[model samples]
Target: MSNREGEGKLIQVKGLIKKYGKLTAVNGVNFTVNKGEIFGLLGPNGAGKTTTIEMLVGLRKPDEGSATLGGYDVVTDVGKMKEVMGVQLQATSLFELLTVEELIEMYGSFYKKQVDIEHLIESMMLLEKKSDRVKNLSGGQKQRLAIALALVHDPDVVFLDEPTTGLDPQARRVLWDIILKLKEDGKTIVLTTHYMDEAHVLCDRIAIIDQGEIIALDTPEKLVKLLHSDNAIEFRVIEGELNWNELPNVTKVTKKSNYIYIYSSNLQETLSHLLFICKEKSIIFQDLHIRAATLEDVFISLTGRRLREE
Candidate 1:
């Protein structure tokens, strides 16, 4: 597939590939992140999101293709990576013995260009905990601090790999605000997240990767627009097996365990037909629900599996 039209492109990746012995972990992937925009890699776990980020950040050398961040060739300009971007991995080993302010200062000391420490602490919502030890901070606090360290040097680009993976909704929102503020402050961001809702809300454009290949790439609205169905009528079958796809006006159907989801082109007509069929067949169904098609539905249409499905 062709890449997006180039305009304000901060990062360009062409035919990027990676291999692990006999396994090709990342296929010939291609995409570009626009300047000051939030570009996301949206996929399930082990879908090569982390591998792509590693190669872009210069932690791992790509076996093929090239990527450029801030006009610096990611392949040949390994030493200049730190000058252009800041990264927060899935897990960061913080100096547990040190206080939050100390850790922030330590990271800033590594770079000649540094943002104000007070502002960094306040912005990450760690102002109250600045004097607290890293070991004493909560799980959410540690994650915030990790990101704070990433921003201390105030690089033009930021890379976050599943930043809100294990956080609660509230903590997740806090992190989300930080990300949004980064964009508002004219910073480019490359984020990798598996949560469809998160990607929908936070990303300007998402590249949906699976099995090391990008299956889809577009804004959240455009990706959802790709779905053939406008509405989804979801329910659970209490008993009996039926050909759900045979239902009228159904663009697609997916059944997981007892739950069946019918993606319908015409919602009211399809719903009426569904009820008629269930009654005629004497099929028991419960928890009937109807909603608009979303990113998960888009993934289902493309891959025939749920976003978080293993």
Candidate 2:
């Protein structure tokens, strides 16, 4: 589904901060999310992505700063804010004995306006498991059910924290389709994820957080373009290491273990020079791979650490 462009901002966050004793969970952070857009919070664990979401959703009061959702201040109008927003937390606890349809109905009872039970089920692709008990459903099915409950109230904005963390590739793609469908229906989405590829595929714009602060925010393509090189050539050297900076068109070089990575804009020149150098030096290069630079590389470049690493 195509995104709704030119939509006005639906969420505003300013100087958002949350503290726990001597430690700060979220430092001064700010960003806005437009209506009918998918805004992603991408960061490693304990980077405060969840804290920021909690502050925006009224689950946690910030030590400093403020946020507003759907024109209502999260602090001053938390009840009103809750009416317009739905949340699927990182760890969702559900009634194990309840059937899927019953669970949806139970959550819908909390809202004044409720969506059709059958339609919500089908929308989440849980029609086949509608009558099954929560405990009997697979991990993917349970995750979909949790999302279904979040939408039963027909919220204007939805918050998903690590929605596809543990799902397999196929199941993750299914959830991606469902999320895109929601965007097509004009619902604003705010998501936090550890998966760089997921953020690249799903988010209209991403805010990269690290050490309790937002380090960068932009569209996926724009973020990746921030790097000097757009392509990466990687291989392992068995004989000896050569000065990577001497390679033609090489912008940056990173070496981890036995593998060396060269980032370059001119892939053809870089590949040709690398091959020539390998032949001249009699360096036995193994497992050669060349691919486009990605958000993962961007994160590593920015933080000097991988997304999953502490």
Candidate 3:
């Protein structure tokens, strides 16, 4: 994407880099976020997703390159740029003693412009918990409150760093709806997430970062198309062993925990080969099934590893 600032492109990053002594946290990173778009940085833990967001939002200084939000340089004009930016970090520290309503109001005092506190609470699904202290809220409720605090200023650009991390599935879905509504309200969002489904559902474009460098950048559909396969086979091996990629019609292989995912160019032929190998090796497998290619498969094909590998 072009670095030229305009009405369409609200954020820009070029050759950004960060270092902690000998280790480079982010290396030569570059991208642009369009206005009213949910752009994602997708990768595993410690894959530079959080570091990149921190640098762009001025939480951590970049050692090289430059970026701008709303045409204000993130490094040099942080104060001016921050006025139009709202941030919900991966871990947000809130006043434990304050009620949800009190916390939202406290944050509102930081910005010159303020959105309706009650409306923000309603949008976050925190209306019922408005009287509850921050420490008394459930995990999901606390996350929503953190997000509400970010939006109290009604900023043009919002940075959400793994907003759904550590949340239950139901709570995660609730946050997803809130994020989508923010876009409908004309807010540009920069999202960092490791969950394949989250990135597929929420992101307009994704940057796949690994080991401090971006390996790929494209729409979710386009990224999956890179494998040149429509079918994926997944199962757990109960006995024996097989090199999945060496089997006929197989395109790629990815292993995480006890499960193995095999991508195939010809479904019937590949299944036949897999059966033959299992019989020959006396291998027993379970949960075998075929499905369509997904963002997880794309990441494995590109990086030769799982997205959330420990």
Candidate 4:
């Protein structure tokens, strides 16, 4: 690992490749994350998100290529890199006997620098449960404790893998607020999530990865635009053999039950064409709706399949 002189980017990955025997987990993945930005690495399960992050955190070395965190090569400077990075993996377990505060202190001791435990506890809203053993805490509380352990070192970069998984709505909201607070504190975050809304709300830019490669990388808005499905027209079809392919600006059409969903970039044109077709075919519909396209649509367009399906 080598550092670039006077560079400000917090993370830079160039042509990174990682293999596990016959399988390639991450293949030629390249992207840079600027300082203090929430860069999301998003994909479905088994999309190499975890593999890429493991390499970034120096837990697993790459088979080929280079990745640098804060200008330090991850593989060569594993010790130094670990010191500067705080990580919360998908499954964070703790000794059943350890209290919240004790666990935080234990993790903090590994760092050369000291962190403010009292302040961190207060900020994380763990004061009430600080003395409770790890086994006695709720799922949200455990996740929060894991986050506290990661931050107790005062690292420059933090990686969260599926932080909100298995969390209830209220717990997810609390986690979101905590993430936003981290951003406000000028910490650079690199996270992976299967939630489209989370990526849309939390990340400044996201790379949509799949099949061991980055298929799309951009701001969420730009990604929607690039796919030409930024907005869509959706409604239930009463009955008819409507020629959906003939509709203007209709790039694709999906039919389910009694519903006909149209993917289009020009909403007005598509709606106009759709209405004309419906009238010509004497089709009736109920509960028609129009809305802007989302990251889910972008993912589907790129993969030709839905997120849940993948």
Candidate 5:
């Protein structure tokens, strides 16, 4: 349950805040990302995700608090930090006139050291489009190129902002594979994403931010455990509608159209009550699934709203 775990804090944020005139973008927030782990910043739109990232990368300055990467201040030592970190902003644009290989070389020139272009291109599956113009490439190909540019310097830390936003399922899977490859090479990644499945599959730890504040932070498994819900039984009833207010041991009951979901800490006791009620007033059910709780359910409990809801 420690917010700061692991040795050697690779990235640290303390009392970070950003404001525009009277409106606050990111209130006081603090967290540290360890080396060689995929850290996820998950939140809905307008949750200050972009602002936080921009401040961390030095694109914008924070009005309060400070952030450091590997003991170097992001603002004061911006040049030093920039050399060791690579960033891919959301909806990043590539030079349409530059060929894929040319664009990668351009990015490589920005750093003191250079990476082998042929090797990087091959690793990113961009060998086939090496000679193609940026504008002519498909969305998936453009995404690969963006990732290639981010990794051209073989940086110690990589920051990605929703790299798979508009991609199809197949394209998303491809990007997922690339992310895993980077992790296997022991690169630390910091990403902001709205896709729950993406975070669940790729992130070792996630911080759920909302309204300019971090509401929850933990490994996906640990966050799900916060619900403390076990042996959940989901079903639909036909004969008689059960009143939620009267259900004992039921901590939360939510309904969407005809589907009802009940979360209980005491599953056996709650089920006993449910069966007793059904016996009294005959009810038929379908699609009954008894399973363990998940991070999705945990988010619902924390926010009382869906993650996709704006």
Candidate 6:
């Protein structure tokens, strides 16, 4: 599904702030979500992604600033806001004794209008486990069920916080597909995750938050392009280390253990110079690998830290 013309903004946040005593969790952050677009809050733990989501979803009132969803103020029109939004937090608690279908029905009953239970089950890929007890489901299945509950009311906007956090590779991919389907169905999705690849693949635009502030906001490709280096070369030396900064066309160099990472805008020049230097110095590099710069590299370049580190 696509956003209709003239219906641009679905969610608007301006100077939103949330403080816990002296420590501010969200500090004067501002952004807008276009209708039917997948917007992401990409940050590490304690970066205030959850805090911002809570404030926008009306679970917690912002200490300062304001926000609106679907033309209704989050603070003043919370009752109406709740009716149109669905939220699946990082940790969701469900009755362990309830069957999957029963749990979906229970959540659906809370709304005046509900979607069909079977459709929700099939859409979430939980048909085989529909009659299974909540406790008997796999980690991915449980997460899917939680999302199904959130969509039971056929909400226009969905807020998912780290929806695939603890799942394995297969499960993570499954959830990715489901999220894409939601976007195809024209649901505006707000996702918060530390996984760079997830944000790169799923988000139409991403806001990179760190230490309670938005440091960068753009499409994933544009964000990566901001680094000015499209290629990354990584390798480990057998004995001694060389200063990679002297290399031609190399933009940045970072070293961890015996391994070195070089970012370059011109891949051919950087690789040719590096090969010449290695041969001249008789240095043997091991485990050499080269690939395109990614969202993780962009984050590190901006913050001087990894996404999962701090």
Using TM-score, give the best candidate's number.
1
lDDT, candidate 3, 102-187, per-residue tens:
98999999889999999999999989999988999998898888888888888889999999999899999998999999999999
Candidate 5 C-alpha lDDT tens digits along 45-137: 888888999999899999999999866788898987787788889868789999998899998998888789999999889898999889999
Model 3 spans > 4 angstroms off: 1-4, 236-249, 253-260, 280-287
Residue 198 displacement in candidate 4 (angstroms)? 0.1
> Against the true structure, what is every candidate's RMSD?
3.4, 3.4, 2.9, 2.9, 4.3, 2.8
Model 1 root mean square deviation, Cα atoms = 3.4
Best lDDT among the predictions, by candidate number: 6
The positional error of residue 143 in candidate 2, measured at the CA in angstroms, is 0.8
Q: Rank the candidates by TM-score, best first.
A: 1, 2, 6, 3, 4, 5
Which residue pairs show backbone clashes in model 5? none
Every model's TM-score: 0.93, 0.93, 0.91, 0.89, 0.86, 0.92
lDDT of 6 at 142: 94
Structure candidate 6, residue pairs in collision: 1-184
The sequence of per-residue lDDT tens digits that candidate 1 reaches over residues 38-57 is: 99999999899999999999
Candidate 6's error at 283, in angstroms? 6.3
Better of 1 and 4 by lDDT: 1
Runs with alpha carbons beyond 4 Å of true place in candidate 1: 1-7, 241-246, 256-258
List lDDT for all candidates, in order.
0.89, 0.89, 0.89, 0.86, 0.84, 0.91
**Inter-residue clash pairs, candidate 2:** none
